[model samples]
Target: MTCALIYRGNDILLCRDENDKLSFPVVDINNYDNSEIIYFETDGTQYAVLPEKTAETIAGGVWRGLRESWGELEPKTWNIAAKGAELAHFMQTNRFCGTCGTALVKASDISRRCPACKREFFPSLSPAIIVLVTRGEEALLVHAKSFRRPFYALVAGFVETGETIEECVAREIYEETSLRVTDIRYFGSQSWPFPSQLMLGFTARYASGRLRWADGELSDGGFFTRESHPLLPSLPSISRRLIDAWLNGEIGGK
Candidate 1:
């Protein structure tokens, strides 16, 4: 028997047991005699993944988007599900070779290859930077226009071509909020996996400029003390970790 992460489109299948505990749906790939079960490994853990159409033949579980499944599944299971979703996205999107019109086949546990040109395709990872900018006792927080909830988050953006991650930190900060930052330093990293993103966290000191948000990107933003900050992102997010670190005297202090 093997544990599996089953996907229904972008949503993942999670089993809710009689005690109301949620877990990854148990799937024995051996039982699905006629189906193709894509397999992947993350952090040295092995898991199988299958699409909703194929998963329909199996019994049980409710479908949930990864965002909704957070904290519901244990931290380790949630991470495994995240990796499964990323791998699923890769499998779904890379069925055809970009260089040629031929279909692809599994090259290894982590890649696909075209039968015609022999080009290998691996899961794509987009790197993004999120920074907690400190101005003395206050940390910078903002509400992005795209947020589904009314919580504030740190300054963040994807790394552009030809820009270093540190440069991306400066560029995204300035582009989104018109603020200059100094003493930019690494904090940590997390697998965002909202369809494959690697979030790199950093801490910086506010260098200059009053907050003026770029149009169409941010709804509201400001610097605030720990006691003055509004609603923040959840514990599962790196944004919250960075903010928590600042408030707890772990980083971003003189």
Candidate 2:
């Protein structure tokens, strides 16, 4: 029997045992003998991927999106599910070689090769910068126009061509809020695989600028301290972590 992460569109299948603990279902690997299923191993656990239609045929489980299941799953299980979903997405999107029209073959567990073009392709990751900008004690938080909810988050943007991560951090803040920052320093990073992104985090001090945000990009922008900040992002997100660190006097000072 092998533990498997069953996927459907953007949801994963999970089962609850008698103890009410959520887990990926364990299935006989041979059951999917002819279907196109993905298989991989990590930290000594062998895992497989089950298509929605096939997995639905099996009884006893509920399908839930990764975001909704974040608090329910153990850290290890959540990481495994996240990795499986990312790999499944990559394999599904990269079925053929871009250089040539030839079908690609498994070059390795995480790579594919085009036999004709002799080109190998791996899972693509887009790196983005998320920063916490400080002015004395207040942190800069912005409400993007695209956010589904009205919650405010730190300044962030995808790294652009010819620009370093540090440059991206400064540019994102300036472009979005018209605020310049200094003392740009590394804070931490997170694997934000909402379709594959590596979030690089940083901390910076406000340099000088009045709040004049780019129209259509931000709805509101301002600096706020721990007690006065608006509704923030939830825990387990690097954004929240950065905010917590600032609130707790972990990182900030000009």
Candidate 2 residue spans exceeding 4 A from truth: none
Clashes of each: 0, 0
Please, what is the whole-model Cα lDDT of each candidate in the order they appear?
0.84, 0.86
Q: Write model 1 residue lDDT over 1-254, tens digit each, in one string.
A: 66777887667887776887987767667777424677777777678887667667657777887877876888888888888888888988899999997999989877899999999999989999999999988899899989999999988899999999999999999989988999999999988877799999999999999788865599898988877789988856888889889889787553
Off by over 4 Å in 1: 17-20, 33-35, 42-45
Q: Candidate 2 residues 100-196, lDDT tens each?
A: 8899998878889999989999999999999999998889888998888879998888999899999999888888888889999999998776888
Task: At residue 108, give the lDDT of candidate 1.
Answer: 85
Per-residue lDDT of 135 in model 1 = 92
